[model samples]
Target: MDSSEQQDNLTESSGCAQAALFGPFQLIMKDGAEVLISNRRARAMLAMLCLAPDEPIDRDHLSRLLWPGRFEAQAKASLRQCLSDLGKLLAAADCDLLDISRSRIGLKAGAVRTDLSDLHDLLTEGKYLEATERLVSIGAIPLLDQMNYGEAFDDWLSVHRQQAEQRLQSAVSVALSALEKGDNLSEYARLSSLWSVRHPPAQTIADRKQGKVRIAVLPFKSIADPADHGFFADGVVDELITSLGQVPQLLVAGRTSSFQFKDSDKPPSKIADTLNVSHLLEGTIYRQGEQVRVAVSLVDAESGFESWAYCYDGSLDDMFAARAEVVQAITNGLSDALKLTEHASQPRKLTSDRKAYGLYLQGRALTIRAIGDGVLPTAIELLEKALEIDPEFAECWTALAEAEINMTVFTPCLDRLERCEKAAGYAKKALCLSPQQAHARIVLAFYAWTQNDIIGALDLAFEAYRLEPNNPDVLNRVGSFLLYCGRSRDALPYIEASIDQDPVNGRNYAILSGVHLNLGNIEAAVEAGQRMVDLGFPSLWLAAALAVSGDREAAIETYQLTKKLMNTVIYPPAGSAPLNPDAMDAYWLMAAKGLWSGKDQDRKNYCMVLEMLHATLHDPCDSTIVLPAIWMGEAPMVFKTLGTQITTANFFAFMSLWTNAEPINRVRLHPDFMDFVERIGMVAAWEKYGWPDLLPKPSTII
Candidate 1:
């Protein structure tokens, strides 16, 4: 009712004005009419909602409160009918039900007026002292005084009561923040994040930019037909797909989506089209004596061409690496389109450090943990200690430097210049002392990459690969570099080598997914992507990969999360380069496009693409360590000189460790960058780095 209206006399009449009385009974009134409810039990129920101004009261607990220990079933039925009748009584008198839910007895706040609400609202609005005094008179009602008398409704009441207290406290907190002279912004942000985590938004992750790849994996036919080996076939196929899908660029199909057509004798091209893919992969599993023979083939959809194929023969004990071999072969087949930079062989040094070398390699192996979880400090400590004990141990020192570099890449708490220099020192020392050592060269290349010295990074990377082609680690690194240069076709051999070396590793899986997706093998990519996610890898890669597979639903949750936590996607300390610049545009655009494989899902994961692009662009310049970028080919566009963005015109040279071989930055300083950016009407560049920052910014690059 409008408070400014002409005063209506407070007297009984046919036009009811619903007013719930607390003491011992319930009554409804509106427009001067009154409906007095004589039952104390019903009134007690009404009192509960009246006390809670805008909160829900559970129905389960209401039954127990009204009837105490008796007539739960009948009382619930009776309560529902009574509430309905009460609703009509209030409505007939022109009262509105603010919220009437089936779960609990809730007052349509508009339908009635209660003194308790006035007090609560007053307190919530910062009149705490006045509200406290009002509570006394309101809490004394005979029916309301029996609130905590029963255990039946205790849980629900306890929950709501706590919520109310929290809301009240939150209001007080907001008011206090405003009143305080100095702000505690960090603390406030942290607390809000805590609350957000506790109760996340409707979407956990945002949509990713979709790529096209509808890939699938056939369930491996078991040669071990005995029921005891029932899990073998499924495990191998899934493992292969899982390892391959870890690359966010692929659109690997899910097992459920692929296995349904398993063993159907479908031709590779036919299967590829059925799955709406440009490429198809087929494999078979067989066991002979103690050895397992696994063969796989990659086929082109257009010409029904057999692009590539390979087979592995190993003992049952070696099954762990079987999937990697298959993945490598498929990647190899698509080598023409996807430049996978990888080495040709593994290191031949049959040496181990007392107790330190094994642990050192193990430590090196654990760097850059799956999404969200940073590498353990213990791993870094172990690598550092190993190096200390064996200063002459070039590999150990190299590993330590790499670890430090990775820390800086993940978070700038590590000194970028100092760490990269130290990494270079260790890696160079290793190379000088052990010229033939592939791992040593790899270390040097890593440091060079950090310094934005593209040529130096590539030279050392190739040397490492030539020296140890079979080393999966080296292969993965080389493939990553090739991918960065847009020489994806050249990257295939390296990735294949790595996968052939260690198929089960998530890195290899991720790499394979990218290779398949780039080759337009949609089915292969999706299968690989889903496999990556299901096998305990981080959801970010899987989400992005699956999003590329046209399954936007799977990637949607994580994509939403990626946006809210935008910091995760944007690298810190990008210096003067704002993300929206044209010089950085291609790197961001192309990489973003390729990173996600499925068209539909990628559309859903749009934020991920942007953040990914931002991270990719920023990481090359801002990153002190290039190993993580190496492991995740997302660093291609991010590569930059230590201090400057290189240009395409000067593409032939490399002055630092962080620069792209192609000199992509020059394009940005060209007319194209300004024209394109102006059209987009984006001011992000202005916000981060003004126009002057890019103009004649040549000297700042390196």
Candidate 2:
């Protein structure tokens, strides 16, 4: 055949053939046959050639692009092999897809058709209809979906994917504009829904503008059966949060903190006080069939006055618009929107798929609930499904990471290493998708601590805190890390702030108790510990405080209460409210004796319980074991444990035990203890935090 005729035939055949580059890469022949390119190099080669069919790329360039790490000779050989394999595969499909020569490689123009090429052309021509059609046909997937080539190919894939997504967004933006101009509202909404599923927006960064007016958007209450419209209320609340967050003049409380009052009966003023905000935006969602009514009020917390109240009645499809109106009203309630930044008043669309958005909100609520309960597995399942529906949802990714971390810490399903790897992987994925995600960074900080990178952990935690200063979870995580790293006094303020944001949060009380104990504020420690117990948390810290405060009867009663509550007689009782470590150990043994008062197996049980307690605090610097050892007159064990854990981040914890144990305080004169003191630099910590009042006086001999 002549050259022109051959070219026409090739174009016709190529048009008949189909290539899908969404979700997964696939090549199908005109005769309904499939072309499989399983090798990574071959796939990369095909994708690059197909993307630019008309241009002939040099063989050397192709080789380096595909195998950048290989030596020149090795890369050339590998490329040649891939070419041979690709040629055979194409031959089987009865197509000459490549123009291969010794010097150059190229795709035979019009010999193969691909979604990527059509997408590029349609977008280049600014044909929004055809572009939207092409995007929908391929399901709006990431470019070269799920392919893992080497670094070079992966980098190329990432750039192309971003470029493709931007094009898709441009088309969707045009549709949205058309809707704004009174045209094709339904069709544009449909297109926008697909685009949203394909490209869910990331969580809004907390405002950093100085002197911003603070507000808390309470979870919109459902005025109907929650089983019917709870998701609607949650979705509305989430959108309102994102909308209000865009206002540079507003310092919005995070969704997690605001949602803490979801089921609370507290009035608007009380909720505002708990969240430490001047204004509260409370709302309710009432839905009937296709119509919805949203009532919102901006209340002045201090004066108990409703500064603005509005009820928006609209179609369910206008939920986004309704939220935008509410946000504008809120801004007006604070100040004039016309005087605010232009971006502050500009309405931003969060999601067009209410179902997917509702699923995401539900997943978040479940994950937050799982923080205290142990339903993390269910939370994870819900989040995973939400991401399945909207893979690019960065907030869902962050929530999934948090749920996985909670499972790792609070549940006993996975091994430590597996849990660490999974939790870290999720956190990294969240950060990769949204770099400014504070919750993701908090998980990463916890992961870093597990990896023993104390400095890096603290840095990440503090950075997360700065991003969302009002987020109680961030505050608690950062504060806990500080306590772990021996900055107890530094941790106190953050923990206290967390309590202010989430007063009934039992974990905050637990952390507060620990911080107070670390700082030698025994009374404050006891008070916080009591709150923790009243809130249904473990009572071990309270028992420890009582034992240390010379309240023997109360201490014993607390231990017995803890045992009864836990349904296990595992803890020991205090006797005579021990004055020193020796007496403390004796009291514990005496308590153990009382436990087996009538059993002939008393001796065996006491030994078993003692060993169990030792095992519980097996960590080298655990103050639990060290304090008891000092009180029990086991000086050698105390020194041995300290010497082993001298390089750990909890060096100050060991020093605290050594200084306050009263009996082991004699270690101040021992050469080994002095060497360790200098090795871990405890002298500086002591000078900074001050020595505990229980510390023994220096020996004149020393």
Candidate 3:
């Protein structure tokens, strides 16, 4: 046959040839014979083409990447020779897979199939279960294993490998979510365990099962008018959960999770199962005028049998004693029923005055809700009034600190550092009054983190955890601090545990999203972000997660929603104008810049608005202005900002420098990174508490 006829015949049979790039590189012919390409550059070029399948890659770009240091003419000449050799090799193997042109190169359409393409097809078809099974069977193997062409090629390979892993993880996340929605618990557990093997939690299953008693205290049903007594009932339940969490052997479900069942129709057994607890404590409260009555029962979750029961009647005037009696009775009953040692420590009352306690409860409720315009300020006012009535109310002080810390973010018009400093002061006062207040410690830890005191922040967070291991807020805070310090693997277990304990709290999910994003679980991050939004908390972090997940439209929508929420928070109807208009402008500008930085197609349109906003801001350090530059991978801008920060000893917005995002990773890869970390005390922090995952150990940092 002639050459053209032979080519036609080869083309007819080419569909049978396949490339496997998920692990080792393989080129299989029609007869399932492996055709070896011994040339390393040829193999890399083939892998690159296979990555994009039938899409064209610029010939110049390919040459530059593979022959990075060569002159343009020499590189192109080498590329042509490499292509000729590769073509001859493929022809010898009876495979015709290249679609070469003068300007571009790509794999021939329908000429080769890849394992990655097959996996993507399965994912596109929504065969998540099959995709997950296939991924598990494939295991945690790197793509194009042991192929290191050069620095440029290695960087390209690293990005592609990460993308591959992200795609697989996204499939797993989708499968898990589907299984959960379908109520397929057995399959969910099996799949979750398998996935967990690849990305292990900080605490192992054995560590979680170390002879601990798990219990959930449900919010008491109110028999009185809810509007008048709901906060009191919630307060009592909150206090009970807090007290129970202090027991050494107890693992109490968080108040947010327990309260999720306050109006639930689910039976106690089901609620207990959902909370992953062996026992459930539930009750009813009735109050009329100054009189109050409480009735409670503890049930075995598995058997659905009542293990203990109690009732108490007391005046509202003696609320502290009444609450104490209820807590003590439950603890004693639990000890007897479960054969556990009784905790001897008594619950500390926050305030002696009844009215002060009432006001504190109301304010705490509003603070926890954290929804509407002026809610935080109103909560602050009520809490301050409570403190006025009883200046030594430690819990009230902690609550005030929490509110102020929240205002640092939610109230854009306020001075950010001023709020943080105020929160620190309140936290300090609370610690002086009650040294064991974990909430106060958490607040102080957050403040310490803002000031870039990594050592002090971690110490305070660890102390808070030791004080109340099962407190969900404390767990989330500690996890957040760890994440900020670039200890994502160490942060994962705490964030997951916090979510398990407080599943309904949007804030917990928000932190979980950050942990997942830093760990490179894009789909899980987006899912967690969506959950936060579904729980009525629109977040810029959610928008960022969506953008990272490649859902640009959804990300833009979320960003718009966040702006609206911020507007409401800053310019509430009937509320005073912003105390600092520039601060407000700075806040909005930073958010806009973040959104703009993530968009490739929208940048041209967004540039004008960004410039306008930038022109309006007087403070150079305002709005975390360097963050957008970092996100855009502008190393010079980042270095310049850091230089100023280092000179002034003020590192505003440097908290996120340690994250594992690609932009931050690129910054870390810069030649000046070691010097930067040393100057910023990150090196010292790493030496004290181990190095971050992305950075090399001190000895290796030449």
Q: On TM-score, who's better, 1 or 3?
A: 3
Q: Once model 1 is optimally superposed onto the true structure by TM-score, how far is the C-alpha of residue 423 displaced, in angstroms?
A: 1.1
Candidate 2 lDDT over residue span 412-506, tens digit each: 33244466567678888877767767778877766665454544565576567555555667778766765644456556766776676566666
lDDT of 1 at 364: 58
Tens-place lDDT per residue, model 1, 608-691, is 444454455433433322222222232233232212432221221221111221122333334444443333221222211111
Clashes of each: 104, 2, 0
Model 3, residue 438: displacement in angstroms? 1.4
What is the full ranking by TM-score, best candidate first? 3, 2, 1
Pairs of residues clashing in candidate 3:
none
Query: Which residue segments of model 1 deviate by more than 4 Å?
Result: 1-376, 410-414, 539-555, 558-702
Model 3 stretches astray by more than 4 angstroms: 1-209, 225-227, 300-305, 539-601, 604-615, 618-630, 634-664, 670-680
Model 3 TM: 0.63
Q: How large is the C-alpha RMSD of every model relative to the true structure?
A: 28.7, 21.0, 17.2
lDDT of 3 at 404: 85
